[model samples]
Target chain A: MDLKQSARDLAIEYLLQEIKKGNLKAGDKLLNERKLSENLGISRVPLREAICTLSTLGILEAHQGDGTYVSDSYSEIFSNIIKKYGIFDRSMVDEVFEARSLFEADAARLAARNHTEDDLVKLEQALKKHENALTDYYEEKLKDKDMMELDTEIHLGIAASSHNNFILEIVKSIRYVTLQQDYFSEQYTLDHEHFKRSSIMHREIFNAIKEKNEDLAYKKMQEHINEIRLALDIESIRRDIK
Target chain B: MDLKQSARDLAIEYLLQEIKKGNLKAGDKLLNERKLSENLGISRVPLREAICTLSTLGILEAHQGDGTYVSDSYSEIFSNIIKKYGIFDRSMVDEVFEARSLFEADAARLAARNHTEDDLVKLEQALKKHENALTDYYEEKLKDKDMMELDTEIHLGIAASSHNNFILEIVKSIRYVTLQQDYFSEQYTLDHEHFKRSSIMHREIFNAIKEKNEDLAYKKMQEHINEIRLALDIESIRRDIK
Candidate 1:
């Protein structure tokens, strides 16, 4: 490895070690450029590059004049990476949906286990929108776009309610990537069945949550995805790619 | 809902429209900071933040002096996000094996269908490394630590030799996330069974490639990952996670 690689590796190694050791607390600021460069025994370039890279990872937060601090916002960093990388081709959409099926199933199960009053209110609100949208074709398109976001809101709400940051963050990251993919946001008009099935799924999922039935919630979530799978043949996605 | 989110939502909506409408092309330079800020009627602070956020998503690439450009490096950006999201968790070790098994099985099948002398040589070199690692545990640690990089070399070699960037890059991203995860580097004695089965798997995969037995090659790849599932356990991971 040349000087640049060596410098970068050293810096990365040092920082990772510090993170692992808990010397770098979530909100602790790092040493400034002058000291950091001297300590790494390298010039400023590679050190800055590594810092920028870590900052991008949400491990560091650079606040202009305020220096770089270890960050608490893992999700923001995660979304940043997803926005950049998770753009997919048509066939990859099938794989993405497969992942989503598994992810949302778990999210629903967890949400069911921990639905607070606030969570119930949000869920009900999303469901009400679906019902209104189903009443008219023109209104449906206007609401269909927001439907996915609301759907995401419920799933995210469940993950948030699960009180597991690790799983919640994972679920959120997966959804973010899935939504950014070719398949998830593909232009579509909702048929009566599409709207009816969606409303039913949410209601069933909500009932499961209200009953605090994890298994029932998970199953319904899977069923919800299976419904989409039946309508949108995975193989048909390959045709779109070509 | 506030200024920051308003800016973010508008930026994403505008960019998505541009992407869909062909108003923005890959590698197109984004409007300069002043112009974009002016157009959006947002302060330089939020506009810069939005552009930086988009750049982090891999949609835009801000070259220091050259202005921000739409990225040609989406694959890397995507891979970085996947890695950052902990998509390579202990759970994914199993999933990676499943995905790799499916992917490499296809890759081997493809290689068998179209193996040149060079492809065969590289495959042999990969097998040799597997063999050498079993005998030389220290080197294996380094190789295994960054196994995705090595795996990428062999897998991409197969995909590239078959001349499919789309298949190559997607599989390449999904395959490497586990190897790039911090969990991979945590101290663990190499499982002898893992090394043994891996050796057997590679030999069979290579033979299928050499003989052009697509079915056999693919099956061997699947068998390889199936064995890997039994060979590694990562509950030790929970201890290392912060």
Candidate 2:
């Protein structure tokens, strides 16, 4: 490795050690550059490079004219990475859906097991919003973008209900990536019948979670995602035939 | 959002769009800063920041005296983020194991469905290595580090056999995080009996894959991971009681 790269890696490793040791924490201001560089026995240049790299990774935040601080969430860093490198070919769409299905199914199972009353209420509201969007779409009063947002909101609510912050963050990041790709590629056509079916699937998943049926929740979520994958695959085939 | 942050986001989004359009590819050198910045309607400063961000994320590589190019694998980026932020409390260890179990079980299923003769050969070799390590441990000749490496290699081989790049990347990242945490905490004592059990589980999983039994592979892998989780939980409780 290059000297600068090695230095950056050392600095990052040290920072992670500090965080693990509870010497540094989320939202805590880091030591000043001079002090930190001196303490790490590295030059200011490599230390700054490491800081910048961490800031870019969303583990650290640098405020203008203010000291840097550890970030409270690594979700944004994850999202940033997803946005940058998650461009997939048409063939990879199924892989994306497969991965999403795995995540959502597991998230649903966890949500069924762990959801609080508050989480149930949130899921109910999200389901209502999704139902309303589906109704509007059926009436020709909602655009695809509105429907997509509502769909994402409902899934995000389920993921949040899982009560596992790590899984929640990852599901959210994957959702963002898939949504961005769909938006950019105009991948899915608005099918009224498919929308109706998806609404029903959403309700089934919600009810399963509310009833605390972990297996049912997992099955419903998995079936819902698999349906979407099938639809996309058919759409791609149709486009190719065109 | 901060102006600079927004600018970087914009540049990153535009670059992603370009990649989706096939204007850039893995190992493709980015356009010169002057031309690219002007084309993207951004100043060079923010553009450079975005480039630096991508480089840090392992999506791009900045070669000394050479222009930057897209990276072939995004696995490094995922591993980097996991390494930086996967510090969890003892309670969260089960959650981590749950997530890993989900990933690894699915990977095992896929491996059973997709593994070629070559893939099976690799997996068998990995299993053999793991079995050797287990024997060494039984004889008090193997270190924790050696055991961990062997364990990771076995899992990585299974993931590779899955033939899904995305799942492989995720499994690799999760393994890196868990191994790092285990190393740092000395969380798992060297239990000869546990090692023997694990070696048996590994063999069962390998046989399932070799037999092309997807469901069996999934079940065995899931059981193996849950066993590990149970052991860790017990270990943590014992430590608490101490």
Candidate 3:
């Protein structure tokens, strides 16, 4: 176990150095497993584990039919690492939300300034999915999980439109953390009323971004996050009273 | 070797689970090594390595003589982990700086709203050290490293005053990544004129935060980061021309 773990670390460290030295680069495909393991003088198992870890960290992307390519996006990397280690817990929910509020507010402002037509198309598509989910929740009895995931997609789309990978990654991490929290899920169950409110706010924020209204985007995003945060606070207060 | 590595990982995972379950907590000291090793059914070596890893990740702290305690700051943890794994490199410097600009601008605004008197004292002390470094740059000839470290201290102090751990941790991670970049240090040599300009801006930021001027604090921080970024851009362009 020790050897395998150290070998995995060694493999990961070696690949990172290769990336750092520009021997490996973004979009470069990985060597085959047997060859890479032979080159590293490690067995296949640890090398595979290393690759899995890197993939989770957004440093690599695996294609369905081809092979893994270096992505090096760094978005979702930090929080994903923490999540993989199982260190994130309920106590972190508030901090994650607080960070999300500030991050997405700025992201909205940046999106207003920097988003391209393609970015707008992607965001609009995400918003459309969210609205469809809301309708399905009331009509076809859609699962809360699907709505929640779509909700996150809309937020992430805005972050991506900001043309800032760092902001996008941070927002991704925040969403990942909150999504993992049990109480967050329980408190944020996608009831129609809650989904309706979120849908309306998401549209307003999206429109501000589309119209290039930086101030309005920032303000609306802040309001949207604050409403959710307030709901979380109320749930916790009620739990305490109980 | 495989056994040792897995043991370390098992120890880390176990501790993380404990923290997540509220069985361990921030500020809680650990059992002695022998007891912990016995409890985990691992040898002392892997257990120690696990402790070391956690300490590097800011999830644990080891005193000079006392046993290790859980810190759980999360600040510096993510970047420190990436650094440990050799994942961070020169390619990340620009993104780190861009994120720092947006994060610190909001951090300054939060500091203006949240800073206590003690926070002001820390900021003032950090500023004083920066000014001293500036004076020594001309007189006693301070090394650029000392000046740069002090410069980071001032910025981190402002982030710390923001009263948001998530913001503090993100800012900490940004500083950690930039500090590790070889080109960053080479490009950011603290010439007297540069130090003087930075000193002036740092003081203005500190004063704005002290006076509880959130808007001014945010604006000043934005200006400060933009100045540094502009200098960086010019230097890169010059290097490219060369």
Per-residue C-alpha lDDT of model 2 across residues B1-242, encoded as one tens digit per residue? 68867887799778777766777888899988999899988898778767876776777888787888888755666777765565432345556676888879989998998789998888788888888777677686877677778888888999888877667777887776666556223455534366678889999999999999999999999999887665554456334421
Per-residue CA lDDT of model 1 for A1-242, tens digit only, reads 35665686578668866865678878888999999999879898678767755764667877767898988765565555444434443345554555456556766776776568887887777677666666663444554446666667666776666544444655676666555544443443323356567777878988898789988987898788777666554565556532
The TM-scores of all predictions, comma-separated, are 0.46, 0.73, 0.75
Of candidates 3 and 1, the better by lDDT: 3
Candidate 1's clash total is 4
Error of 2 at B164 (Å): 1.4
Enumerate the candidates' DockQ scores in order.
0.06, 0.28, 0.28
Give candidate 1 regions above 4 Å deviation. A1-142, A157-187, A190-192, A202-223, A229-242, B1-186, B199-237
Encode model 1's per-residue lDDT on B1-242: one tens digit a residue: 35654675566567656764678888898888788778877677556555655564566776766887887655565455554444232354444454455455555666677667987787778767656666555445455554534544655666554433334554566554545554445354236446556667678777877888877977887787666555554555444442
Alpha-carbon deviation at A140 in model 1, angstroms: 7.0
Per-prediction tally of clashes: 4, 0, 11
* Candidate 2 CAPRI-style tier: acceptable
Better of 1 and 2 by DockQ: 2
Off by over 4 Å in 2: A1-76, A83-90, A183-187, A233-242, B1-76, B83-90, B183-187, B233-242
Residue A194 in model 3: lDDT: 67
How far off is residue B110 in model 1, in Å?
A: 14
Model 3, runs deviating above 4 Å? A1-10, A14-36, A42-76, A80-91, A183-192, A233-242, B1-10, B14-36, B43-75, B80-94, B183-192, B233-242
